[model samples]
Target: MTHNVAILGASGYTGAELVRLISQHPDIQIAALAAERKAGMEMADVFPHLRHLSLPTLCKIGEIDFSTIDLCFCALPHKTSQEVISALPADLKIVDLSADFRLSDPEEYEKWYGNPHSAVEMQKEAVYGLTEFNREAIANARLVAGTGCNAATGQFVLRPLIAADVIDLDDIILDMKCAVSGAGRALKENLLHAELSEGYNAYALGSTHRHLGEFDEQFSAIAGRPVKVQFTPHLLPVNRGILATTYVKGDAKAIYAALEAAYKDEPFVELLPFGQGPSTHNVRGSNFVHIGVAEDRLEGRAIVIAALDNLTKGSSGQALQNANLMLGLEETAGLMMAPLFP
Candidate 1:
């Protein structure tokens, strides 16, 4: 059986990525594409790379017929998604790719996002869309919230450790390097070629990155207490992927064991051999996550790393993963393509 899905913000990078992946899906079809600012323009024109494929002309969200859509992927921006999703059909199954529904508490959402969540009712029902950690719940959810690319990468390394009690919970540090595309396709002076090329710098320092809200919420839930990691994010000049290097006081053997056991059966997450590490180049343009663990100079300290394409596994691909389970389709369908590498 085939499913017809619509993309609510098809003009952006994530939306175009959804189109590229779904074009090869055996059980899903792109029914409509909406791009408010670019309404009435061809998707191909907006994204020249997609010119060869046939896709709907970008339309405003109001023009979409929600009833015909089996599921809708809302790739709209943070605050914008709340308003749009709040007004969407009540019965429409949705996989939101924005930060709008990711945090369960409206108060917490306001704390991190700087605005009260407008869709409190729907927010309460949304399932966190980390396919590895919350697969069963995602399968039955009508509203699935995709994790932030940075948040998702960090969790991939820490969740298992927290669950297995392999790492020192109170003293964890995450140093992340994210590609510029992770900032989104929106034009910004800092993202320009002249400004960003051959240069790298840290932005959200001193544990001020917004994704930390997710870390606090999820880690705390797992450990049954408040768990906050020292997190600092840097902007890399590269065009794709996120690599999170996490420091923890734990037995290297145990850290590797916990991670290995957790992702042993996960199709998209790969655990590198002990002492080996992963690079962003290995996971570009794919939903795969490569994790590695190594011992620090200090005997009890360990370093855990995780890497994935910020745009693919980090956002659009993750949205599709949840959308698959929500529709009762195989969780891995439409997402098994190999990573692009030089």
Candidate 2:
């Protein structure tokens, strides 16, 4: 009953996370690990935290024996993800944790990513990998496109309200704070400990963040009309979670009721008790998403807050969730670990 899987980009943050998580899967096994630049290195050398587990030595994608892999998780960056995925075996089941195939339109992909898609035909079959919302599609999909971490956090807050028509869609505003890990494990001057510690700043203001494309595409599709929200993302000094504070002009009780109904039966998403809000501290290192709704003193306004480990529920955990469905395995396998708390 075990499925063998391969992980591309095994040296990156998300890739290592996939390894850490899949190591515990009851029905899955990591048969191959690929990290183009770090090929031939032991995964233990690339990520010491995972040294306890016996894992395959990293190799290039071309070196993987696709015939033995039942599923593949690509944790590569945007453009590279598509290029590699396009060249992968057509029959390989892929869960891509990249922005490449999330957008359904090739033109929209070009607009946000600034280049023509290398695999336009592939987009037609890719399912957006927000597990809670796209479970059915993901179960049948060969290629599942994992959402942007910020996009996943925001949707956790807004998707229910939009679908239930409990909020003023045009006036929605999302102020999110994401930890540094969501930027990936790349070295950059801005991400230096000295440059980011004890300080925080906002980027991609004015709805310019690329994740906005996800918001537009998903929200608009749900409403059957154009629904654009004001989204602003901030970089926090911390290393692992995402907190999204959403402002919506709607009855607080109604918003709460809608969210409650939406996630009541869901395993990974928790809707807090009425008038209570969540903190990123509670959901760190777990696949769970904690969401809360508080009534603003001003009538017709409600504040909805959501939190999760950007590395877990935001990316790798989500990819694994979709992989479970795609493989016809239990959806929550290997993902119910309790959040790490100080």
lDDT leader: 2
TM-scores, each model vs. reference: 0.99, 0.99
Cα lDDT tens digits, model 1, 108-220, are 99999999899999998999999989989999898999999999999999999999999889999999999998888889999999999989899987856889899999999
Sequence-dependent TM-score of model 1: 0.99
Residue 24 alpha-carbon offset, candidate 1, angstroms: 0.7
Error of 1 at 22 (Å): 0.4
lDDT of 2 at 129: 95
lDDT by candidate, in order shown:
0.93, 0.94
